[model samples]
Target: MSDHELRKAAHDLDVTVWVGKGGIDPVVDEASDQLKERDLIKVKFLRAARAGTSVEALTEELAERTNATVIETRGNTGVLHR
Candidate 1:
């Protein structure tokens, strides 16, 4: 789907994964598993997780680790597609 369409669909998805101070490693497995079951998944990054990094950066890193495509990053949330 187009980015716009993906974003629209993602808007309604509840965050199925969360990244905390431990960062991407802790959630990579869960995100990857969820993507196997769902076309789109939303992830929320906590303030501790953000640390010195931006949401987009974390989102991109997580997407890369999970082998998923980043749909978008907004606020501290991001959507991923496999």
Candidate 2:
């Protein structure tokens, strides 16, 4: 998705975003449940900046780990599939 799309989604659905690392499993589990009901999830990454992980790698890693579709990246903000 493009920045415009991301912004529209954020504005339309009232997305919730946050930062964390090494806790992707539980997060995905809970998010999966939420997705079943609502179909959207957005998680902003902070670990990559703090821990020196490349944004592309971090996005790929998280997408692989969570089996989520990477919907968009606008700067450091990442939008994920539900």
The number of clashing residue pairs in each candidate reads: 0, 0
- Total backbone clashes of model 2? 0
TM-score of structure candidate 2: 0.58
Model 2 lDDT per residue over 1-82, tens place: 5656755775455445444655354455655565556545666666634277655666566666666666666555566665
Could you tell me which 10 consecutive residues in candidate 2 have the lowest summed lDDT? 10-19
Q: Model 1 segments beyond 4 Å from truth?
A: none
Q: What overall lDDT goes with each candidate model?
A: 0.94, 0.58
Candidate 2 clashing pairs, residues 3+ apart or interchain: none
RMSD after Cα superposition, model 1 = 0.7
Best by lDDT: 1
